[model samples]
Target chain A: MSERPAHGWQTVREEVLRRIAEKIWRPGDPIPNEADLAAELGCARATVNRALRSLSDDGLLDRRRKGGTRIARQPVGRATIEIPLIRTAIAERGARYGYRLIERQEAVAPGAVSAALGTAADAAFLHVVSLHLADEAPYALEDRWIVLGTVPEARDEGFEAISANEWLVRHLPFTRAESEFSAVPAAAARSGALDTAPGDALIVHRRRTWLGDKPITQVDMTFAPGHRIRTQQ
Target chain B: MSERPAHGWQTVREEVLRRIAEKIWRPGDPIPNEADLAAELGCARATVNRALRSLSDDGLLDRRRKGGTRIARQPVGRATIEIPLIRTAIAERGARYGYRLIERQEAVAPGAVSAALGTAADAAFLHVVSLHLADEAPYALEDRWIVLGTVPEARDEGFEAISANEWLVRHLPFTRAESEFSAVPAAAARSGALDTAPGDALIVHRRRTWLGDKPITQVDMTFAPGHRIRTQQ
Candidate 1:
């Protein structure tokens, strides 16, 4: 089925893949052309194209420029990345989830923080230091700064009762954000955050969220060594 | 607009973010709820939800329970993991893309490969080791094993001209896939895959793609110490 249709790419791909997998089109065997499949399925050629395109991307078929499509000789690995909530991810894995407000204070925005918050450098900002836990073990250290100019109500919204994630979900109203994932060798402070050895490689997720036409928050989320975020495509 | 809409989430998000950048909703300003947004945009609520949910996730709005949503005090960093061709990623970064044909043997699958390929444990399999280069720099060392029993035709397919990634995309007919992302300290032989310093964090992508119920490929893609993949939500 098309994304526009009830049966999306997953459904059609399943049907086609089952045929090939069952040796309906054994390796080296040519599969039906897109036109034929489109007509057979009462769908457009584009729908078939999407299915084939994804299958090819996943390394299941042999599609060449004008050579047509065939079953792959050997399937290649297909991997997907999943984004997860930090707290649940830790807890589900049988780890304790804890948060510590290391630094929470009212301050003036620095140039960089101001730029990130889309506020003037002199704007009031809330700087909060937080440590995250997994199974009572130190997992991540977060150095988060909130724009007090933008969140006056946040001045007294103690983070002790709930987690920043849950609080943000409830009070923060930005409709857009960006997440950057990277790996870096650990520095001392970072090592302290994760209870890691010196020079440990850390998986870093730096996230920024924005209100409509306004800058709001910047969070630096650094994970302990061996931490992973799973995702699918 | 929807997935079928001219602008996908990416395009819409950028536009909306720009509006917010322009201060349509300044920091701490309350924005309309999603329902009102859907109405104003004349699009599906789901689309609005996707956009809004992403925004909330990014920490732009201070979302509350019936208290309404507002801009964050400080904007979060935009964390984007760029999903590019592995080859392109290395090449663009001025490293040589390298490959090595580890073992070109046709044999029955091993335990895990068998289960993944949906074939007998002894299903014909092709094992190869290839290294990815970035401008003559070692970026990734791949230990790839393919099960030919499920897709036997790859037995004679020459993998010389193209990278496994490119070759696989051109060939294969898979329907569903699952992948896992992890960060692990380098294993023994792996330490030499990309000439990494021992104990550096290596980002590992473990994946298994399926054709219908038939397992097709199981692969482990290990990045060098500094490789990063970015995705925006």
Candidate 2:
């Protein structure tokens, strides 16, 4: 292989990753300091630093403030969990996507919902129930509560043409989000909606999003049995 | 609030992120180049670069080689998923953990396994079946295949004392890993092992690890109903 001095930071990053993959820099071994790496690679020290920092973010390197950087002895591979818009998720699976709005109304927030939203227990919010179908089969049932104070426009949009999921993504892009995945037994009402047997184990993907300090929305989505979510770098 | 020149890259990062969050630099707006930001902040361009790079990594900013940097119009919040060790995962949940080695044998690779491993269909591998218990209740069942050429020492370890999962983590320390999560119906064999009804939905966490180009191991772990995994950022 013809070799030339690597130029850009990304090129340096690839070189470093390849070295690590080849075991040239074994785990737990201290790599050269920034200055030395810069000298050897004939690049600016900042470029080398950027490459190292990116690798550290990927959990490939362990960098300390003073102790320098080292190959992580117990490197944990991080998988990025991208919160997918349900429509895109379904379409990616090569299935015809369908949506039906079951119910939409303004209701007093329950204790749990209010607590999760960090709002008054008696606060009223727009609550909506919708079903997502893949190939005309029930794929997921979504129960969502929208804080009107954070998303007042949601009250006017009748979710008949566009799903609240898509609406929020377009209007309010969240700065922070949390997701919880679990297997739960389907209750009677949910079973009838999802067309699954009562007590059948269903996958729940619960998510809450925030726009700065304001809670945007919280949704509990229960998927039909045999649903899958894949995460990768 | 007193204003002072930021001293370090991390402070610069915080300031930049706060700006983006507060809409001082609104989404889809082009940010100043690194040199100008460094001049404005009275720091080196490298420091500004570091801050901008970090924000980009967090999905707060979008950077293109030629297009420069801009606030992402539709920013997607990324959740870092740390691959968990089952023992540590259970212990973190405040549950007593137990393990049992159900079966271990050398078997010819099946079609799917061979395809995944990229090996001959008739190649023999060490297959293991084990069960994890939480508070004396069935928790998960693990079915694993270890490549003999990559991990020959696994043949000597009886797995009665230490699990293959922990053993591989300690010995192999794979450089790469892939994980997939899905809800699956428990088959007759898996149901008997997990003490669950056949056709009950189980959460499956399938993972494969590699050391460079060599396949190290592949495991399919099925969790009991009600199991949960949470990720936040």
**Each candidate's DockQ score against the native complex?**
0.29, 0.32
lDDT of 1 at B2: 27
The segments of candidate 2 whose C-alpha lies over 4 angstroms from its true place after superposition are: A1-71, A186-188, A197-200, B1-71, B75-77, B186-188, B192-200
Off by over 4 Å in 1: A1-15, A18-84, A90-96, A107-124, A186-188, A198-200, B1-83, B90-123, B186-188
lDDT of each: 0.67, 0.77
Q: Model 2, chain A: how large is the TM-score? A: 0.75
TM-score against truth, every candidate: 0.66, 0.75
Question: Tens digits of per-residue lDDT for model 1 on A1-233?
Answer: 22564566666787777677665765677788999988888777887899999878766677987978877765333333444556766777887788776777888756876776578878887777777887678888776777665556678778775556556544545655666566666653545767777656677776776656556677777887777665454
What lDDT score goes with residue B155 in model 2? 82
Q: Compute the lDDT of residue B103 as modeled in candidate 2.
A: 92
Model 2 chain A weakest lDDT span, ten residues long: A1-10
Report the TM-score of the second chain of model 2 against its true counterpart.
Answer: 0.76
Candidate with best lDDT:
2
| A14-84: candidate 2 lDDT, tens digit per residue | 77866765557767788999899999988889889888887787666789888889887662456677767
